[model samples]
Target: MKNSNIKNIIFDLGDVILNIDVPVASLSFAKLSGREQAEILTLFKENDLFRQFETGLLDEASFRNLIRKLVDSPDWTDEMIDTAWNSLLLDMPVERVELLKTLRSKYRLFLLSNTSSIHITQVNKILEAATGIKNLDELFDKVYLSYEMGIMKPDPEIYLQVLKEQNIKAEETLFLDDNSDNIKSAAKLGIDTILVQKPVTILEYLKDYAV
Candidate 1:
């Protein structure tokens, strides 16, 4: 069922490759300030914490410190913040990495993610330190991050930018994202897409391609 017409494989980096553990951070905040997860998330999100953090309106240190304060716990330590921020990191599967290495020769690979500079640094360090998958940088022809690009997924403009930059037709590009809304947005732009889900990784889903 694979479409041979697809020439470009656009990947969503987080959750697709690097696992994201949002609840860990959310729960940590809740526990630190003695609040419920729902309440903590509401205040954190309502205050535009992620947007500001991504846009560099607030630096990493300041962002963490501020969020801790909002949780009403000014006494929280740096370790607490780091632990909360990083609690969601999961191992990158070697099998998937090898699969990508094989796919590199056949199709152009690109990485698109809604990420901030701080999170990327942490992820890079964690990934390289543990797995030594050094070629991740070389495998992808382009790596686009929302914080750096000023546009995030689920936004048509970001998808437009990718097709424009690559000079490729949307139909010829297969975008893989863990976020359903992002897939829907790209689908609207005429791009082929796969909404990655639980128990199904990009590699497992694409294995039948027999490429």
Candidate 2:
């Protein structure tokens, strides 16, 4: 059964709805650069380039250029870079799509993801292929992308902006994300949250509501 007090639901894209493997992408990049996967993963953690790209501080071309420099592969093409970067995005399960469709009928649904333009494009393609949905906009009442909004999650400003724009109360909203930091931030704002961790997807977590 749905939470009676919750009128809105905000969903995180990666790991929550869309399946992603960060190490898979790192491995792909590593193969291309002849570096160990651990080295690539460490680079991702230590560098702010990804955060900059997610927040729209870097354009696609500039982001690609920076990636080339980081991997020390100046000859890598845009297609190659995008392919390696996009390897993390796996698939959107059809059942998750069905769950969203069912929930949409009863609540205001929203997509709030910290992602770049490149990932969004590929995700939409994945969505289209899986469920014939044109885009995530069709699944959610509103979509707040980090690249479009100039803000990222775990930041109070981003959560506040969504609440302000949607005219929704924090206490009446439910947020689901795979990241504990993100769940903590939302909880601090008085929004109910579920940390969608391994062995328990949003589908499994909200099975009663789906029923």
Candidate 3:
């Protein structure tokens, strides 16, 4: 399908623009929790705490308390917990930001990320430290965070809400995400989508569209 009608672009944060290392997080959490890395990974997949934290259902203090309980260690400091939790956020590629800068002139750009407070904080810090940009605000017209919106990707409501708030039509909007489920959900809503895959960055995938 031709996406020449797509004028607004919605970009996913993790794995699309920023690199994520889930195994690194598991290893880091394992160090603090005294559990095996495999066990920690399993817990991360099976536990509702992670999803709750992402959707803002659990406050930072409560999330930390839950983590403490899960690890069976109440004495761990907030910093330590944050360190382990943030291990998954690796880095944001400068090339991706440069591409966004180029595309901003051609498309109405927005950021739609499913992330929590801790992860967002770390992402901002990494961006500022590496590129001298405090956050993605300058790169995007609007930023919609799942934690702040109390919604996440793969949910039809979030896409509909973005379209309504941005005053854009679904057929005119393009959504790029690394996850297939997210792409499928957006596609179901009639939004053009590109499933960002490994070995091919967003720039590589949308090279023709941006021009």
The best candidate in terms of lDDT: 2
lDDT of 3 at 179: 88
Q: After superposition, how far is residue 20 of candidate 3 from its true place, in Å?
A: 0.8
Report every candidate's CA lDDT. 0.80, 0.92, 0.89
Clash counts for all predictions:
0, 0, 0
Overlapping backbone residue pairs in candidate 3 total 0
As for candidate 2, its clashing pairs are none
The Cα RMSD of model 1 versus the native structure comes to 2.0
Candidate 2 ranges beyond 4 A from true positions: none
Residue-wise C-alpha lDDT for candidate 3, range 165-187, written one tens digit per residue: 98999999999999899999999
- Regions more than 4 Å wrong, model 1: 75-79, 134-136
Candidate 2 lDDT trough over 10 residues, lowest sum: 202-211
Q: Per-residue alpha-carbon lDDT of model 1 for 1-211, expressed as tens digits?
A: 5988988889987778877776887887777677899998899888988777765677778887787678777787877877777776666666667777788888888988887776777777766765685535765888887887776788899999988998989989999998899999999999999988978887777886536
Q: For residues 1-211, what per-residue lDDT tens digits would candidate 2 score against the true structure?
A: 4577988999999999999997788899999999999998788778887899999999999999988888889999999999998999999999999999998998899999999999999999999999999799999999999999998999999999999999999999999999999999999999999999987788888776666
Candidate 3 achieves a global lDDT of 0.89
